[model samples]
Target chain A: MRKTFITAILLVLAAFTARAQTQEPEMADALRANGKIYVVVTVLATIFAGIIIFLVRLDRKMTKIEKNN
Target chain B: MRTWWWKILCILLVGYTVIAGFLIPVPRLDILNETIRNLYFHVPMWFTMIALFTASGIYAIKYLRSGRLQDDIYSAHYAITGIAFSVYGMLTGMEWAKFTWGEAWSNDPKQLGSAMCMLIYFAYLVLRNGLKDEEKRAKISAVYNIFAYALMIPLIFILPRMVDSLHPGNGGNPAFKQYDLDSNMRLVFYPAVTGWMLLGFWMATLRIRLHLYRFKKENSFAFENN
Candidate 1:
């Protein structure tokens, strides 16, 4: 079961890598487009994800403090 | 978050929207002519919906993992926001279709996929309302929200892409494809996406804040009585 799960994940990663490779030459073309919006979307998404991470950490600290109490 | 930042951000966003929204692209299709302006509204609405729902689905997964009520609240708002986007997309598509296709609506794969997605989330809301217990509401709603959304992305984005339709950038049309981005259009297009995404984030944060306030108030009330 574990082997199968590992293999499945590996296959998924391989497909993603392959997809990225296929998109590479187009990367030059994509870069040419000056897709400022994509950058903005990506940055905003990262910030939101960062907030989630921070919240998780804060929750953990709160839990520990409560346990001490 | 408790500062004047939101008000400032909203003012800037609305200002940008008015300026960019009217500066409409010189119509790419001769037949469509100025009809291309529909894209400003159509694309942004659809993108916002997708972003909001994605945020919701993420929350659903987290809620399931940690059994947190706050996660459930965020998930619900996200689902509703996704529905709002789907509605805007459908309506905008209908108008565009009427102009371009000479018929307002058709059983297109993309349309059907969107309808299906909206229905699933609507049912999710109904499912949540069915349960009275807080824990059960969180558990059942979280499970269904996750399941429905897992099915939603592929069925709407992926499956529809596999089939042809009147829509551009789908099936085999490169006209609307990302690769077709002309240098000129990219100037406006990319920022348009950013602006729309920012707006979507803005809405989600508003919804989340309202939820937090309600949750805090309710728990305090519960604690007081206890």
Candidate 2:
């Protein structure tokens, strides 16, 4: 158990070191760099619109059963 | 008899989940990059898990008030579903953490809190299993569910933010505040939360219907035999 605990600590240290060494890429900046995230956002919006259509039905069914005995 | 609107809606939701779940490329992040998009699955699983347990708690209370077996059955079904989602959530979170947090395990407040929440529900199941009488089982499980639900809030939300966190959004790490998070991600994220929640309920409802049917069948058979 002691060995396992020590290993866990060492591993966490390794991750911090890696993050410090590597220049992290910011997604917002990258999307701004490429200028495509807005379009991607629009696509995601349309997909969720489809999901709402499906869920409303299920909600109505649940309400119906709850209403009846 | 004819509720075309819901039918139409369900088709759209399924199509959206499938398309958004797979089609859109995950956005890039600094620390985790596009890999973080797995939040779409990982986060929602816990959200649904919470909703299921909250919902079960309500039914368990109702059973105590009304002496209805059906309410107890509903509680059981939802508790089971919550456990299933918790398993999926923990697995996905572990995978996400390994890649992003740089390790497979940590005692970080968020990590520990989530684990605690899973244990509370697992205990709820154990309470039910230990009882032989149906009435006793409902009473015992209902009491357990109430306490479990009460404990879950502080464990998942309040405590995690109180201390150091290896997880983003904690540990003074300047994670996404509501406004800082991408509006585009919210577009998929909010619907994803709702969609999975409804689907979780759909699973519970199917189980409830099957239970009701079996109950009725047994009663009819008893009557005929008598």
Candidate 3:
């Protein structure tokens, strides 16, 4: 009886693991695994930072013009 | 208007959005796949546009109440900035749709409504520019702006919900909130909207300041003679 109980518990655990694997839809696991996604993230962040810097400079120029006015 | 804190916050929030938006774990769905991350970038454009347009409408009311050209300048610049954001929203939405929806221009109810909304605002600009007299232009456009804003509410918000739309949150389609926009996404989504709205406001303020400078320059001689 104890052997049968152990076998049932092991079977249930195996089914849960198999379902977890098959149920998951495809994601960027390959890109993430190879770590190339970080490259894209870095490029985007850099471009955004550049835009922010440009805006700040423009804001300062506007302030200077306003002061002279 | 020149406060630095919110600008700084905008930078921080948007920067965080870019990083966390890409890194965060999203729901593993079949069709959406990785494009679910577009939620952080795409939806915020519309939110920012709406916020800017709302500001434009408020400034229009203020202009009518005070008969101040400065308020008119504020109104026009806010509308212009809002339109710019809308262009971005449309472009990004189309790009996302092309991949996921199998085509870009599917004549979706939401798309048609937004297109019509843009055309109405464009006509408002044309109407303003056609009047050479400054006072008349400001007053007429201010009234038109109020009407345009009133029309926008139903076209973009109400009509889309009333009809069947391929866009989520409308028709029989389940909204992102029903499934995809879980707590993990909300943390990034709300901040993304706030950051983009702040950035749009900053751009509008800069344009308003430039317009004010020109107005002062032109009127300076009159003041000096007095």
The TM-scores, chain A only, for the candidates as listed are 0.44, 0.42, 0.68
Per-residue alpha-carbon lDDT of model 2 for B1-226, expressed as tens digits? 1334444454456456545654455444566776656766688888899999889999989998998888998998998988888889889988888878888787778889989998988988888899999889988888888999999999987888788897767667566544335766666667777767766776676567657656667777999999
Among residues 3 or more apart in sequence or in different chains, the pairs in candidate 1 whose N, CA or C atoms overlap within 3 Å are A37-B190
Residue B140 shift from truth in candidate 1, angstroms: 0.9
Q: In terms of lDDT, which candidate is strongest?
A: 3
Q: Give the distance in Å from residue B85's predicted Cα in candidate 1 to where it truly belongs.
A: 2.0
Identify the CAPRI category of the predicted complex in candidate 2. incorrect
Off by over 4 Å in 3: A1-23
Could you give the candidate ranking by TM-score, starting with the highest?
3, 2, 1
Could you tell which candidate, 1 or 2, scores higher by DockQ? 2
TM-score of each: 0.70, 0.72, 0.92
Q: Can you tell me which runs of candidate 2 are displaced by over 4 Å?
A: A1-69, B1-11, B21-27, B171-180, B222-226
Better of 1 and 3 by lDDT: 3
Ranking by DockQ: 3, 2, 1
Q: What lDDT, from 0 to 1, does candidate 1 have?
A: 0.69
**Could you tell me how far off, in angstroms, the CA of residue B154 lies in candidate 2 after the best superposition?**
1.0
